[model samples]
Target: MHITMHDIYKSFGTNRVLTGVNFDLQEGEIHALMGENGAGKSTLMNILIGLHQRDQGTIMIDDKETYFESPKEAEQRGIAFIHQELNVWSDMTVLDNLFIGKERTSNFGLLNMKEMKALATEQFRKLSVSIPLNQEAGKCSVGEKQMIEIAKALMTDAKVIVMDEPTAALTEREIRKLFEVIASLKKDGVSIVYISHRMEEIFEICDRITVMRDGKTVDTKAIPETNFDDVVKKMVGREITDRYPERTSNLGEIVLEVKNTSKKGQFKDVSFSLRAGEILGFSGLMGSGRTEIMRTVFGIDSLDKGEIWVHGKKVSIRNPEDAVKAGIGFVTEDRKDEGLVLDFSIRDNMVLTNLHSFAPKGLIKDKKEQEFVDVLIKRLQIKTQSSATLVRSLSGGNQQKVVIAKWIGIGLSVLILDEPTRGVDVGAKREIYQLMNELTERGVAIIMVSSELPEVLGMSDRILVVHEGHISGELSKQEATQENIMTLATGGQ
Candidate 1:
């Protein structure tokens, strides 16, 4: 089925989003919607799925003007939305979550468990997914949970599927599987509206691309007719002259060291060192214990056997507070749940890490807090109306800035970042890279764990490859290559 959205206009109170935006999808074709954070991509899709009402617009499905008052109505019309954040219940079994709210029932109104299980199994087989039907949703890995979400879409017999950042949390292998599923869906004549920030994936999987910027449609073109640089320019409305800034910081003595770190099944025999004014990168496939190592060092997880030394002093960090007191800051990979409190105001989150500084006299000095927040907001270029704005209201890029600002407020000698630019746009990424450069110039060491190979090679002075909970190999900036990194990451000689 062909779908068209014309002159879509939506607003929340005085904040206007999606001003006169247009989007279209062809039957059985994979169309990508590309944009920077807060560029109305989500708003436009929410309108299409009936999550929010468009102030002014027209939605044409199969050339028929249609209005849906709720998501259920849209679903009944064969439109399925696969959210970026999986919507499965953690406590429920995969089988139960698959047929939620639309279960088949007998004449007596009892759920047909046998039929539902069979259908769920068949859907998994169709997608080549290996998740067990009886396993609890929460117990499954992130990639497996994502597969289950796709199976849920199939259970609805959806004709048009809207996928939002489907591979954001997936590893290389899982991403390949997802692409295979998308190809299969296209072969079955199912249209897909894929939204993602990963440019390589778009070039590989999408037939067409639509770009949006600042609440307006920028341009749409066939994949073969355009390139990555051109699309980035359209998305940000400017030429990004440099993706990575020049490294000017001089390497100094070691600032932090982890020796023989072992965390049972999580990771084992991990060892690394960070020098002053150096950006040390940790690269590996997902679930290779990269994140676990960072968490253990930051005191979020206990170390079974290891030693942490800061500035040549052996420090025992039993918790985050201890880590912070040791002059270390960590920006977690899952920013929404761990880095910032979405319900809190920007000012509150900005000062969360260093609240003691603001309340030294046992009472928060509001004027002093405001001054600090304003300076950081300007420095970080976080887009928001005021410090009073809730963190949840900000876009993904701005929210990440808030998290970074929080850590920056607390004076630090070392910083740990995991997937720092996971869901942000290209422009924001450049800004972050510039910030990292500035920090290192000030003699602050940083340890970054990234899945993007180019990012690791571009920004890191030294790279450490982790495989199956161990430090597989180490390479200098001049020696590191994608092939070598992958070889080490996959347990090579």
Candidate 2:
């Protein structure tokens, strides 16, 4: 075995995050560590990388016991971690970000800029990424940034690399490219610990699968010996009879319409219509303008020139308040930065958007507020100790549920979700799917923007692919395939 973790336990205060978790990684093999959000996948990975100390555990690397006091120690021992969130600097160039911490000094004590750039260039070549070395990393697309992150880890001469949702932000084409890179890495005998909610990718790439649930390891099986359904059943502890809720042909008249929506440098000629009881999916490459289209529609960013119609009447949306007033709900891609108020409790955040409805005689109704929050908590299956628990104290999936519940409480005719299940676990993702079906059943229109091809394919009745600020293609549920979507997304004519 390349790495072995036994009897791992970690806790935050009185709450246990990881419980007696055990896992092993073998050389020249791809091992998938599967779990839902708050299931201790991140905690266990952090322990391996030394971000958090385990309460009890024994870590063995290459058949020898090892203790990592810091991430640098883990790095020196040929271990590298690629986080879900990119850790590169936005202000620095790609070459600089890769070589910033450890610079090779010449005999005269000068930084070796030429050698560093050459090495960074070589690494990018190996990954089939063509990012400019001198360009600021922030200007690159999310997929480019991801490739850069992985390249940095590889540059460390890592024997084992733990990737957390590496393809969450990538498009179908980029995902295929990533799989190729992973295959090459496996051929070179690099052990990979892959964590993802995507079971299809797990079956496609991983050699062995380890299932984690409620902070404990349930089973580890070879990929060929197990299937996606079996792995999901193990991760969720129940069989999912339906991947998506039943859709009825009960769509009402057009609720929201965009006429030739153009955001100049962001998106162009984006025309789409949403009606009650329909889920429309927007999909494309990282910079394909899916999120940008949502932002423009939500009035977070001004449209260069376009006409918006709500309920068959032309309306000018100058700000988010206008969009909200028009009965449009938007859950942004960056939830932490744009969606949640981390310091507030669930009740406070729940009523933030619709406080006027619950306030009586200009007085906030605490009891009524609690009632509303409680209803949402239960409706969305949001796991929490209490409705009064601070939003930040919850896991990523629970936090997302809170965000969705907040909007569902306010009442919306058109809902826009950008990467709604990006970091969410399988169980929570299924719950969200069920909630979407329930909402559609009640005649609510949904516009979902996602980077996961399988998710978009599985959940959407219609899919729109964007490429370089324009709509490249639109595919129906029957026509949508990984091959066709990737063809259009990567500039195929």
Candidate 3:
């Protein structure tokens, strides 16, 4: 075995997150760790990478017992981790990001510029990525940034690598390139602990799969021996018979219309009409103006020139507050940055949108607020001990639920969801999709922006492919395919 974690136990304060977790990975194998949201997948990965120490456990690496005191120590011991949150300096160059902490120094403690640059260039070439060593990292696309994060792991000469949702922001082509890199690394005898929400990816690349549920190991099986349903059942402790609920609402008149919408350098000439009970999907690469258009529509970004019609009436939305007042709700792409207040309690985050409505003379009505939050928590099935728990303590999947629930409380007519299921697990994603269907059934119009092609195609009634700050093509549900979307999104229209 390349790595073995036995009887792992971890907790935060009085809450036990991971309990008696056991996992093993063989050399040259991609071991998959599957679990529901807040099932302790990330906690286990953090423990392995030395971000969080296990309360009790035995880790055997390379036939010897090992304990990592810090992330640096883990890297020194040939273990590297790429967290879901891309950790890279935006101001630094790609080369600098890869060799930031592991730079080669002389015996006198002097920096070795020539050797470092040479090594960085060699690694970039080997990875088949053409990145300027001196260019700022912020100028790169999300895929490029993700590639830089992956390359950074290689700098440590990592014998074992743990990637948590690495492909969340990557395009299909970029994901393919990453798979190729993983294959090369496997041939070089590196064991990979791959954690992803995509079932296709797990079956495609991983050799063995370990499923966890409620902080316990449910099963460990070979990839070919099990299917998606089996894995999902193991993770959620329930069978998901239906992934997306049926859409059974009659189409209504256009509720939101954006005509000739342009934000100058950001997005241009984006025109679309959304009707009641319609879920319009915006598909594109990371920098292809999908999120920019959503931000512009939500009034988070200034629109240089455009006209927005709400129910056939012209509306001027200068800010997010104005957008909210106009019966529009926006769920941003970066959940950690814009979605929820990590330090705030679930009840606080839930009622934040309508806090003023629940307040009298600037004093919050605790009874009224609690009533609504309690209903929402149960309705959404948010996995939390209490509504008073911090939003940060909840898993990524549950945090996304809180985001959706927040917008749902607004009684929105036009909902714009950007990467709604970006970090959400399968079961939670299904719940979200069902929730979208329920909203539309009640005549709510939705505009969804997603990088995952299957989701865009599966959930949207119509998909608009954006490329270079403009819409390249638009397709109905029957006409949309991954190939067609990618071709148009890459300017091959």
Ranked candidates (TM-score, high to low): 3, 1, 2
Q: Name the regions of candidate 1 deviating beyond 4 angstroms.
A: 103-136, 139-145
lDDT of 1 by residue, 1-493 (tens): 8999999999888889879999999999999999988898978888998899999989999999987898899999999998765688889999888988888998899999899988988888777777888999877655567778878987888899999878776667668878988898899999999998888999999999999998999998999999989999999888887788888759999999999989998898888889999999999887789988998899998999989999999999999999999999999877766788999999999998888988998999889989999999898778777899999888777888888888885779999988888777888888899999888888899999887888899999999999999889999999999999989999995
Score each candidate by Cα lDDT.
0.88, 0.85, 0.87
Q: How well does model 1 score by local distance difference test?
A: 0.88
What RMSD, rounded to one decimal, does every model reach? Answer: 2.2, 2.4, 2.2
Candidate 1 weakest lDDT stretch, 10 residues: 138-147
Is candidate 1 or 2 superior in lDDT? 1
- Expressed as tens digits, the lDDT of each residue in 1-493 for candidate 3 is 3888999999899889989999999998999999988889999988887889999989898789987889888888788899876787888877778788777898889988888889888877777778788889977755677778887887778888999888987777778878998998999999999999999999999999999988899999999999999998889888998777666656799999999999877788889899999999999877778888888788888899999999999999999999999999998867776799999999988888888778868998889889999998998889898999999888877898898888876678999998889778998898899889989989999999888988998889988999989999999888999999999999997
Candidate 2 deviant stretches above 4 angstroms: 108-110, 139-141, 360-362, 388-390, 490-493
Which candidate has the highest lDDT of all? 1
Clash count, candidate 1: 0
Model 2 TM: 0.92
State every prediction's TM-score relative to the real structure. Answer: 0.93, 0.92, 0.94
